[model samples]
Target: MLKARVITAIFLLIGFLAALFLLSPLGWTLLATVVAMLAAWEWGGLMRLVGIQRIAVALLLGVPCTTLMLAQPEALGLSGSLDKGAALSLAWWFLLPALGFWTLLVPLWLVRRFPLSGTAFGLLTGAVVLLPTWLALVLLRHLGPWALLGIMALVWIADIAAYFTGRAFGRRKLAPQISPGKTWEGAYGAVAGVLIYGLAVYFLSGSALALPLLLLIPTLLVLTAVSIIGDLFESLLKRQAGIKDSSQLLPGHGGILDRIDSLTSTLPLVTLLWLVL
Candidate 1:
């Protein structure tokens, strides 16, 4: 299992890097939309929406995603304006759903462990989580591919730290029912790992979170925890769906949502903060 996972991860990283660096903005946008649509399909499965229901869900998401991208075809370019054009207007729109879902509802759902399976609420939750993350991907890629890459690296770092550290020294449960594999020690390790990465970006890259150095660390820490929220939220969905993985779409990676779960939370929030400041 471990070997399969490692090999899949390596190939995924390679393919991802190639697309990130080589694709034109329009090309990247199309690729991102396809990925989001696949996640939407898996999300529909979790909602127990079958056949036509799943196809409906896919079009429901894809149509709006197409609209958003069409709204700012140029803003996704290196020369596009993020301040005055469609991107800015939609950024404000994106901010509300992402913030509301992550800040108000998700934490409550996590604490309460609400019975959200196959419900309208679960469908709404999937929309809220998936849409803004898609928005973030487009906006960040437009800003610059490097910007997108750096922000994603933060989530990647946190996940890696949590995995290895949890394996080595995990003790107390982070959320026993939703995700038994998680641990408080792993959370701490993720924080430390993101901290190191954040500071490295701050000092070395000089592309820290457009905030004071002291303030950036706290922001990174919050984002780290938020990434965990994203991970656990999907785990909860899979739990309610009574499944071990979202789907066996990626040899060892489970599915699209399984791979990008953390990004679903972290990316939108990070982009919101970036746009705000």
Candidate 2:
């Protein structure tokens, strides 16, 4: 299992890096759309959709992505400038709501242990969870691949730090019902790790982020907490769905959704923040 996971991680990293640095803007958008589509399919599994139904759900989610790419190419940074166009409009119209969902509602849903129910609710929620993330992937990469990579690395650092810290010092549970493996100590470790990473990037990358330390530190802390919320939220869904993993598509890594779960939550907010400030 470990060997499969390592090999898979290596390949995924290589493919992701190639796409990130080498792909054209449209190519990157298409790749992100494909990822969103697959995640939507797994989301169908969580909602109890089967076979063709899952495929349909994937298509349903993917259509809007392709539509935005084709219909409003400028908005997606595919053709023209996104500085004062639909992309800015979308920052408010599309991603603001997504930001609200992640920062406001998801934490409540997590605490209440809300039951995932109703087809309409499920589908709408899936869109809320997905579309903005797809947009974030497109916009953030366009801003700069290394910028996007640095932000993503914050999440990776947090996750790694949390795992080791939890093993070493975990005592009290963070979310015992949703994910028993996580702990408050681990959460602290994640925050610390992210803070260190944020500071390093700020110093090393010079004007890359363009935020002062005061603002940057708070932002990093918030994102780290939200990343944990994202992970916990997915774990809750999988628990309620009575499944071990989202799907078995990624060999030992569970599924695409399993891998990008934190990204779904964090990316939209990062994009929104960049747009705002």
Candidate 3:
């Protein structure tokens, strides 16, 4: 598993660098949309929306949504004067439904006992899990490569820190019901790692720090917490479905969704922060 993970990481790093430095920003946007669409496909399966209808629905819903999100600055709102920051903020704010839906699913999971049995319920749940994340990716990509890289770095740092911390010292389970392996210690590590990473990026980019390091630290910490929630949220979904990982797309990482769960939650918040403050 570790070897596979290393291999996958190498490939992902190569791809990301290529996209960031070699490809046009437009190309990055296109690639991001494609990834979003693929995630939507995986989401359809998780939702129990299988067969041709599932594909059709996912494409119909995911494609236009991804396109509009990516094109939001120019195509959807405020015409030419549309603020990228504002648009990202709005997207994050709009993700409330997805968050609410996930919260609601907790009770359902506890009550239904066999929650994943119903196709309709699964489809709705899947939509809640899938759409926001896809939209977040679109918004991040649209924010330009720097913003996208920043978002990605946060997720990556969180995951890496969480893994090492949890392995080194993980006595208390953070969410044993959802993901037994996750630990509070690891969660804290994730927060710390991401905040430090955010600070590094902020300084390295030579961007003016409108806010103090203290303020930025807390913001990144909050974003890291949100990212963990996103991972646990998806883990809960998979647990109820009697599945492990979102898909077998990656040799060790599971699927795109598995790799991106943190980003799914963090990106929107980052986008919102970038715009609002």
Candidate 4:
């Protein structure tokens, strides 16, 4: 399993780096669209949409992304929208609200453990989570490959830290029903890891973004929590759907949705911050 995971990660990294460095603006849009298509398919599974229904849901979500990529409309408001696509313009509408949804609303929903199992609501949920993330990737890449990579690193650092910390010191369950493996200690470790990562970023390139070092900390802390919310969210969906790993699509990563679940929340919120700050 570990070997498979390592190999997959190597390939994923190679592909990501290739896309990051080699793709033109439109190429990146297409790349993001492909990701959206696969993610939408997995999201359909989470919604319990099978057969034609699965493809339908995936297409339903992916088509909008495709339109946004092709149209590149100026009305939606995006920095890099001029030549690439209107992904952010359309994305912001969803992702802006998503920022609030993941930050404040999701935590509450998790605590309550609402039985959100209806198909209509499930499709809506997929829209809320997947669309913005797809756009966020596009927007981040537009900002600069390093920008995307740096922000993404925060999540990676947090995830690794949380894993080790949780295994070493985890006691209390973070979400017993949704995910028994997660713990409060793990959550703290993730935050601590993000803080340190943020500091490193600040020292290295924070000035380039024009965000102050101190100011960046609070936002990173908030996003740190948001990243955790993203993970538990998919876990919740999987529990409700009665599935183990989203799908066996990847050798070790499980599925596209499973791999990018945290990204589904974190990236959009970060992109939102990028627009405002």
lDDT of 3 by residue, 125-150 (tens): 55555566655655555455666776
| Root mean square deviation (Cα) for candidate 4 | 2.6
Residue 80 alpha-carbon offset, candidate 1, angstroms: 4.6
| Lowest lDDT block of 10, candidate 1 | 75-84
Question: TM-scores of all models?
Answer: 0.92, 0.97, 0.79, 0.92
TM-score comparison, 1 vs 3, better candidate: 1
Best by TM-score: 2
Against the unseen true structure, what C-alpha lDDT does each candidate score? 0.83, 0.90, 0.67, 0.81
lDDT tens digits by residue: candidate 1, 197-276 = 99998899776868789789889988998899989988987898888888777888899999999999988887777766
What TM-score quantifies how close candidate 1 is to the native fold?
A: 0.92
Candidate 3, residue 222: Cα displacement in angstroms equals 1.1
* Pairs in clash, predicted candidate 1: none
**How big is the RMSD of model 1?**
2.0
TM-score result, candidate 2: 0.97
The C-alpha stretches of model 4 lying farther than 4 A from their native spots are 73-92, 206-209
Q: Give the TM-score of candidate 4.
A: 0.92
Candidate number achieving the greatest lDDT relative to the actual structure: 2
